[model samples]
Target: MSILSLENVKYSFENTNILNGIDLKISKGDCVSIIGTSGSGKSTLLKLCSDLISPTSGSISFYEKDYNSYEPINLRKQISYCVQIPYLFGDTVYQNLSYPFKIRKQEVNKDKIIKFMKKLNLDESYLEKGINSLSGGEKQRVALIRNLLYKPEILLLDEVTSGLDSQNAKIVQDLIKDLNEDGVTVMWITHSLEQSESIFNKRIQIEQGKIVKEEILK
Candidate 1:
C-alpha cells in the first residue's frame, strides 16, 4: 500500500504558485528522492507532506487517510522531518538524545541510544561531551539518532547529508539505506544526482514546481 499520496497538489504564496498539480505516490520501504535545483519547491513539497504548511489546493493522504484528519502533533511524531542543518539542544550529547523521549513522558533507554550512536560511528564516550564541543558532522549524527530512536513510520529528509564530510556522509548514507531495508519509508530531497542514483530506488524530478519525470531505477 502507498504510505503517502499527493493528488493534484498546488501551493502558492501571495497568489504566486509554487507547486502546480503535483501527483505522486510513495510506498512503504521505498527510498524515493526528489531532485531539483534550488528554489524548485523541493523543501516546500516536504513541508506539505509533513503538514507543516497546507496546500493551496488538492489533497495529501498518509496511510490512506487524509492528512487533515490527523492531529498535528500526532502526525509529526509518526513522520519525522530532518533538515539539512541539524539543531541540537541540551548541554551534553546524552541530554540531546534523551530530549524527545523526555518531552513525550517516556523513560530514556540508554542501551538503545548507545547502539544507534554506534551505528553512526559515534563512540559511547561522546555521550557525556557537551554539544557545543562537537563538529557539524557529530551534531548531525546525534540529531539523526534522536529522530530514529522512536522509529517513526516515515522519515522526511531535506539535504540531510549536505553538510557532512566524505566519511561522515558515507555513514549517513549507509544508515539511510539500513533504515529503508528495515521498512521505513524515506522521502529525501537532494541536489546530488549521484547520491540520488546510489541511495534511492525511485526518482522524481521537479522543475518550476511541476513533476517533469518519475523514474524507477534498479
Candidate 2:
C-alpha cells in the first residue's frame, strides 16, 4: 500500500491558484525529487503534503486514511517538513536540538544528535554555540538534525541544501541518501538539476502548477 497519496489535489490562495490537479503516490522508501522554476508552486505542494496547509479540492491520504482523520500534531510527527530557510528557536544549538524530544516527552539523545551533527560536518562543540553566532549553513544543519531525532516516516525537504557550500551540500546529500536507503520516504524540492539527478530515484518537474514530466531513474 502507498504510504501517502494525493488525488487531483488543487490549492489556491487569495483567489489565485497555486497548484492545479496534483496527483502523487509515495510508497515506502521512495526518494522523489521535485524540480521547477521559481513560482511554479513547488513549495506550496510540499506544504500541502506535509499538512501545513490543506488542498482546495480533492483528497490526501496517509496510510489509506484521510488527512483530517489524524490530529495535526500526530500527523506531523510522522511527516516531517524541513524548510528552505530553517527556523531555529531558543538561544543555543542544544536548545533547538532538544525541542523535538521535549515535545514528545522523551529524553534527548545527545549521542545521536552529536552523530548527526558530525555527519553534516558540524563539530561537537557546536552544541554550545549561540544560534546567532552560526552561519546559514550551520543553522540548516542543526535544524535537519532536530528533524531526524525522532525518525519520521516521511521527510519533506524544501531546498535543504540551499544555504550550504558545495562540499557541505554533498555531505548533506550523502546523509539523505543513506537515510532513504534505511527506509525513510523522502520528497525533496530542489533547483539544482545536478543534485536532483544524483540523489533521487524518481524525479518530477512542475511548470505553472502542473507536473510536466516524471522520470524513474532506478
Candidate 3:
C-alpha cells in the first residue's frame, strides 16, 4: 500500500477553490518534486498532506488509515512540514532545537545536533547565537535540523532552499537526497525546475490547483 494516498482531495478558501480534486499516491522512499506557477495551490497541497489544514472534500490516508484518525500531535510528528519562511521560537538556537526532544521526553542529543550543524556548515558555537541575529538562510537551516532530530516518516518541504545561496541550496539538496535514501518519503515544492530535475525521481506539475502532469524522472 502507498505510504500516503490522496483521493480526489479538494480545498477552498473563502469560497475560492484553492485545490480541485487532487489524487496522488506517494510510496515509501519516493522523493517527489512538486512544481507549478505561483498560485497553483502547491503550498496548499503540502499543508493538506501535513494535516495542518483539513480538506474540504475527499480523503487523505496515511499508512492505510484515515489521516485524521491519529491525534494531531502524533500525526504531525510522523509527517514533518517545513515551510519556506520557517518560524523559529525561543532566544537561542539551542532552545529551538531542544524542543523536539523535550516534547518527546528524550534527552537532547547535543552531539548529534552538532554533527548535523557541521554538515550544514554551521559550527558548534551557533547553538548559543540568538535567533534574531541569524540571517534568513541560517534560520532555515536551523529549522530544518530541528525537524530532522526525530527523523519523521515523511518530509513535506515548500521552497525550503529559496532563501539560500547556490552552495547552501546544494547542501540542503544533498542532505535531502541522503535522507530519502535512508527511507524517508519526501514531497518538496519548488519553482526551480533545474533543482527539481536534479534531486527528485518523480515530478508533478500543478496548474490552477489541479495536477496537470505527473512523470517519473530518470
Using all chains and alpha carbons, the TM-scores for the candidates as numbered come to: 0.94, 0.98, 0.98
Which lDDT values do the candidates have, in the order given?
0.90, 0.93, 0.94
Local accuracy of candidate 2 as per-residue lDDT tens digits, 15-133? 99999999988888899999999999999998998999999999999999999999999999999999999899889999999889888899988998888888999989999999999
Candidate 1 error regions (>4 Å): none
Candidate 1 has a TM-score of: 0.94
* Cα error of candidate 3 at position 181, Å: 0.4
Comparing 2 and 3 on TM-score, the stronger one: 3
Name every residue pair that clashes in candidate 3: none
Name the top lDDT candidate: 3
TM-score of 2: 0.98
Superposition TM-score, candidate 3 onto the true structure: 0.98
Runs of candidate 2 with Cα error greater than 4 angstroms are none
Query: Higher TM-score: candidate 1 or 2?
Result: 2
Please tell me which predicted candidate would have the highest TM-score against the true structure: 3
Model 3 misplaced stretches (Cα beyond 4 Å): none
Would you give me the overall lDDT of model 2? 0.93
List, residue by residue over 1-218, the lDDT tens digit for candidate 1.
88999999999999899999999999988899889988889999999988899999999999999999999999999999887788887699999998888989989889999999988889899999999999887888888998999888999999888878888888889989988899899999988888999878899999999999999987
